[model samples]
Target: MAEQVQVFGFWESPFSRRVELALKLKGVEYQYFEEDLPHNKSDLLLKYNPIHKKVPVLLHHGKPIAESLVILEYIDDVWKENYPILPHHPHQRALARFWAKFIDDKVVVAVVKAAGSRGEDREKAIKEAREALETLEKEIEKSNKLFGGDDIGFVDIVGTVIAGWIPAIEECFGFQLLTTDNFPNLIKWSDQVVNHSIVNQILPPKTEIVAFMKANWKF
Candidate 1:
């Protein structure tokens, strides 16, 4: 029997987009359910991901996978034929996973949490986010066009938020976190990543993202 795949996710979520990109790159056909999030979550979503009660729950032949990064690895492992998400070498694969975790835990999380803060707390969040970005900036400077060299890989997928959501975060918070002067390599990399054929095809419209942020964020 053919595999049954379904994704429960939110449209604005970077996590959801990561799974979507992985599926698209591997040419996997699946059903997509957009969750209401923080208000209403479907029974299926809740059943599959009770621990987090979050979107980006991937159902594969009835087995459930929660967490976007874990789902990405699963997709890559299952498909294994085309558009490999992680590097083939063992050492390189380890490094890819490391950077993916770093971006999620350090950069994306910090910047986003800070974007919603106020006063001195906000300042400290921004400071920590900048420190994380600086670390990533040096990493990107070592590659050409992407963290994985010529093509998108695990780290690249994890770093997608820097391209797609950071702009909206900056707009809503009324400050720029990524700039040509402070992060030239990352800026160039963001441009390339957002414009990559697979990514550009699926990326949500920037204006809509900006409007959504303004509506949802207190800033």
Candidate 2:
């Protein structure tokens, strides 16, 4: 019965890991199929997500769901009897979604753009990434714990990309962008997220991720 859920994912993808973590937190069992991105994509992945042509696709029973964020929401809604990803309070849930959108529009895309560009384009990308991170830092200074303010919650699960991946970027780039002194709250929040027992199961080893970023991306 539990095997009805299937996950198509890529290694080292923050989005994929987010969905995986959500499933783990909710105690849902699913078959995982790894996909090669921008290269060799699986036939089922092509069939499941003909539009996006991307991984992190979730198949429940026989219905297919694409996009990691969408997949997370689906997982939580499907398994809502146990763990709830979005808050019961509408305002809190909106805040959570807002920050997740912020990360996507600001940090994730900007970092990749910077990593792939050069000269002035790279400089602009870097600046955009830094500003986005500063926003994250300020949020942490206020929240004092997970994004939910107490126990680990939805936004924290989605935002794990920031907690688990950002410092690795600093190390791989040999830069001091996310410094502890400047972002004390963010640093503390990262430590808290990584230390969560469930998060450890979904996040990749820091060393391996750093190496991958160094080889695949510029910074």
Best by lDDT: 1
lDDT scores of the candidates, listed in order: 0.88, 0.82
Model 2 CA lDDT for position 150: 72
List of clashing residue pairs for candidate 1: none
Q: What would the per-residue lDDT of candidate 2 be over residues 16-52, giving only the tens digit for each residue?
A: 8888899888888889998876479989999999998
Which window of ten consecutive residues has the lowest lDDT sum in model 2?
170-179
After TM-score superposition, the amount by which residue 112's alpha carbon in candidate 1 deviates from its true location, in angstroms, is 1.8
Clash count of each predicted structure = 0, 0
Give me the displacement of residue 16 in model 2, in angstroms. Answer: 0.6
Looking at candidate 1, the ten consecutive residues that score lowest on lDDT are 210-219
Q: Give the CA lDDT, 0 to 100, for residue 206 in model 2.
A: 86
Q: How would you encode candidate 1's per-residue C-alpha lDDT over 1-55 as one tens digit per residue?
A: 2359998999888899989998999889988888986578889888999998897
Error of 2 at 44 (Å): 0.5
